[model samples]
Target chain A: MSLSGLNSLYREVILDHSEHPHHKKNLKQATSKVTLKNPTCGDVINLELNLVDGKIADIGFTGEGCTISQSSASMMTDVVLGKTTEDGLEMAQIFSEMVMGQKRSAADLKKLGDAAILSSVMQFPARIKCATLCWWALRKSLGENVDD
Target chain B: MDSKFLKIRNDFPILNQKINNERLVYLDNAATSQKPQAVIDEIVRYYQNDNANTHRSVHTLGERATEEYEAARGKVQRFINAKESREIIFTQGTTDSLNLVASTYGEENISAGDEIVVSYMEHHSNLIPWQQLALRKHAILKYIELTNDGRLDMDDAQKKITDKTKVVAIAHVSNVLGVTNDIKKMAQIAHIHNAVMVIDGAQAVPNQPVDVQALDADFYAFSGHKMLGPMGIGVLYGKNNLLNKMSPYQYGGEMINFVEKYQSTWADIPWKFEAGTQNVAGAIGLGKAIDYLTEIGMQNIANYEQKLVEYALPKLLNIPEITVYGPHSPKLHNGVISFNLKGLHPHDLATALDMDGVAVRAGHHCAQPLMKYLNVVATARASFYIYNTVDDVDQLIYAIQDAKEFFKV
Candidate 1:
């Protein structure tokens, strides 16, 4: 066959983020620290957020998983860094919807930042759980149920 | 063996198809084996000729269904060398069969402070039911550790199974490690301790010849889908004496012989456990599958798989940056191998292999405790069967090399 589909899923940017993840250090003091794991695939994400004055001043994650899951966690931290807690939650919801084959407006898609590139991930049904694990961690740290 | 075992691959039409423009090298046999045309045809014939609820109706189709269903039970009994056909109880799959034993036999034998012994390598189906059973009955759950070579530690097993151990459940073969357990020795130990020995034979019955009476196991459970049969049909082979003493797992119409206002009598040893309407078509297909396996000869199938593992294991180990789990040779590990490439994750490696039309299982293989024991999160596994050839292993090696180059590892 062709490497086209595999290459699309494992984009260069995604690989770079997976290789050199941003804000992947442990936080000593944080507003909330939530650890979530994809029991199906064993992908784990320990997400810590500095929710200062209702805004996500800093966000970091530490875990081991596939490139898609790790890069998704990296990009999630990048997009939700300076956003409000509510906006971060909304961005996670939008990213989840986009990966689930939802058609989001460009304006709404912009809210997800680098996570929008995972739109091709919808074709790989098995990897969808990997892509959304970090987002589930984000929702959990914000006092929401992790399971959908 | 002759080329007949190889020619049997042609009987499975799905094996002739292509994936991603390449010939599909289906290697995930431990997860589920491909069904031959005979089994598929039997399922269709059941739907077309005999489609009726069994055991309750007097119609012609119902009689045919009941006959076919019981015939399938007899097939399973003969397949495993069980003394009585009534020892075979049909259920959903291996998981359901295991749960039946745990809920019924476990509830009757195990009391508070009693111990249930299982190994570290059990799949969740075999592990969780006992774990839940222990939790409910306030019993203790003990583990039989693995040896340094990844085989079951028989000395530890001897130590763990004591008078307090009311049940000893273990896998006949490791789904992840592919190492065969010493079930005969384990059963002897359980007998010395007066505990029932339950063998999770899901991975074993498909690849090797299993004689339950020879093994002296009290209960042997396996799934039909893993052995070229249709899904949703599984067999639970229990000793007649123990089955008579145990209670029924479910309360339903068919499993009852006589029902009063508040009391009920179970149908029989096997039927008492098989509650509700059973999967008649699945049972018929499983019987056909057993016929196919019998025609191939289980000894020949075992030898073919042994040759495949002998050819593949050394080649797999020769590859740099590849770490294979379980025993190094075919002497113990059999046809399954779990390994990890140096830099690539198993999920990504599996996807890359899929691009080459190679199907493999890339996860914990439903043994998270074993995953933790192996000190890795997950690994890619490619299991072989009678239909798989050495060429499939070469394809797997090439896929691993391609992944290493692609990921720049």
Candidate 2:
């Protein structure tokens, strides 16, 4: 109970997003949809995005997973809605880099919106994949030039 | 903690350590048991004193190596009460042994319309090989359903196994559910249908006493590392008559009697199955592990674990919002418990528990069929062995509660 590492890893904000995830239903009329699975832990996400011209007009996700993954997906939908696909992919890179322990500038940190609290996920090496599941799906769905 | 387990755990050096500033509470026995110091020292002694290629030389070290290697086979033969040492083949692990049967015996016996029966509770290792075999031979694959309490339904089993059934493979104990199937009665049913019986004993051999003769299993397979032994060493117990007739799965050195340019004759029953260089040190270490367990007695180990489950299962059921899979009574199964905290995912729960220096497995447990049968995506598992104590279970319960509170479930 006194483990400070656990406290930061499961912060209040992250738990809130996980419990009450945003855009948690199926986007049946989506323009682009992609499914990703973490075969090791069986966490899966079906990411649906509505691209109007060059912007993500709407976003939603449906999946079953641990708190870190579900909440990460939830927070991602809130951050990427109404943003250009370019901005969404850029935000994903900044978010991935931040969680991977790369030094992020203040501007890049600000782009993550509410997901910046998940930077402590790096401390638990086993859970980094759980934290990055949605971002990968987004990058894949948008057909971005990801350096994965 | 039981008085017997206190001394039993002392044999393992890795258990007497700490992780993240807390004593390690290892409840991951179903994944793999910790190695005893005796098994470790035996592995080291082989390298230090008797290190040489076995069965192909006349030098002193070579002779010593061959003696110890085949002596290890004798130990395994005695461990499972096989008819002869030749009936026990050295395999890389349980998956390898089961695959050998599926490839060799299955290929020879299965016709285009033949049937292979497997239970719903089987691990992927036991399920996939026969699945591929059925696909390859154009045969039929049938499954026996599970009962409400997670045990195999005998009525369903009888109905599924029929005249077209040429083979039946089953898990001796479910890795996820912890229910021990009555393979003795199952073997009888398979025999009545003129079918062969194969038992996947990977989970059972580690916790209970298994006698293939008593079970009448045509082929029994298990991994050594699960039973306080080293990795890379396992045993396949096949009846000599059946093994003598089946074709070799893998063809290479040490497994053949004569190799012509076009044709080759096999060496013998077990050697024909074990190709290339085997895990000599691992086999010796596994033998030493058997010696360690034999000294403790497998029956005593089973009895003690049953008591541990009887003590722990009820308390776990008492937790709010906790959903446990498998039999409610401990006497009906071994010491494997799979449960879930309603709203929290197993991965998050396992990570939180790890922060408290507790280690348990969280996943589909390589038994997705059983997971589907139980109606869940995944679950958290806490499995016990001879080295585990009641105190470990207490800490696990406490850690689970902490996870529940942290997630505000």
Candidate 3:
């Protein structure tokens, strides 16, 4: 692989999302909260979910991480906002499988919306955890047993 | 410039490989050094011939293995200028050696309200053991501050190590910053307070000459893999009186003198600490690594690495986007250089550099407290070794420049 291969991992969309992340804040009224750390690299994510009637009414995150993690978190929060807890959990699972290079139908991946762009993360095994860290935080906050 | 050190790279076969269609420039020596063929051959030669349980069976192979293992101990003793081979104990790595000291010596010595002082720049292997020991004993764990340039604050060390201080543990060299601490003076301070000084030489032993007696360190720990030997083998050097007094780190067959149902007597100092069957092949491999380093000479290695740093550091600092941690002057810095780009995280920088086949370490480097102290989550570190050449340093700079262009930062 040449340096040009980095283009697949750090596309313009990913760079834009990382540079100007959405929902990068703390929610004043968080129903459930979880903080996860990628211990190997010291990357941390504090995810706040304001769940109203089993739906993610609002979602926010605050932490320090690399570009992939930050952009992945941005994309994750964009897709999961206003999503039902069940749908959010399923989406997290799909995202995990997607980054791990597992097969997903177009219809199943379409549910991820813009977050599907992260399917390329499979090529960079080292950064797979960085991409999934925020999703793990989302799963744990939505009452899933994420043993991260 | 074709230097003799550049010629030394031929001894390491791994350095000849290519990554990402570019020459592999290994700058992760702080994490682990690549083994030379001599050490590799020594390990293979041992497994082929002297594969037997040491200090047991009276067979020829067992005796040969035992002699080789003990001879490795003698090499380690001379390598660090230890007074006796009995003071050296084989361990898994620097972490295991440190844990041994904490579990045995710290368990016996530390009590409530005593002070255990360490520096802010210590790696986790050196820090957590002492921190947990203090926690277990209800002792106060104090941190000696670093200067603005990232050097260990000697005044703060002097102030922190009072009469109540029972143990003073510090790294002989910072893995991230590459600044050598004043171990001799620090040991003097600890001795004045009647505290035992433990030196973590994991990074130091591989980079420069270390004399435990001259530094007056009561206990010193270092890993073999970081010094070009195999993993799962390390050395813990301690004073004879201290080793005799400390309890056995573990209980098992080799460390036993005689066992009777429930009661058991322990073996001598070194063997008492080395519980089960040891890493005999790894020990012999480390002996070979010591021999290789001895041939080149530690002072010569140190001097050559210093020249590389002097050449590389100014060029690295010239990049406006880079923020280097540690002393800015080449005279004060060693080979380990940690830095971060202006708009790029270290992880991103490391990945970008890897694309150019320059392997650097990017993380907290197991020095999370130091990272926190530096107010950054992580940083990219490029460390040098004997086989590293000036061309490798140029590749590192070019990669950084390429990363900057690729990221448009």
Higher-scoring candidate on TM-score, 2 or 3: 3
Query: Against the unseen true structure, what C-alpha lDDT does each candidate score?
Result: 0.90, 0.90, 0.94
Q: Which candidate number would show the highest DockQ if scored against the true structure? A: 3
Error of 1 at B271 (Å): 1.6
The numbered model that scores best in TM-score is: 3
User: How much TM-score does chain B earn in each model?
Assistant: 0.98, 0.98, 0.99
- What would the TM-score be for candidate 1 when compared with the true structure? 0.97
Flag regions of model 3 displaced more than 4 Å. Answer: none
**Superposed model 2: Cα runs more than 4 Å off:** A1-3, A144-148
Q: After superposition, how far is residue A23 of candidate 2 from its true place, in Å?
A: 1.2
lDDT of 1 at B294: 91
Rank list by TM-score: 3, 2, 1
What are the models' TM-scores?
Answer: 0.97, 0.97, 0.99
Model 2 chain A — which ten-residue stretch has the worst lDDT? A1-10
Which ranges of candidate 1 are over 4 A from the true structure?
A143-148
lDDT of 3 by residue, A22-100 (tens): 9999999999889999999999999999999989999999999999999999999999999999999999989999999
TM-score quality measure for candidate 3? 0.99
lDDT of 2 by residue, B242-269 (tens): 9999998888898999999999899988
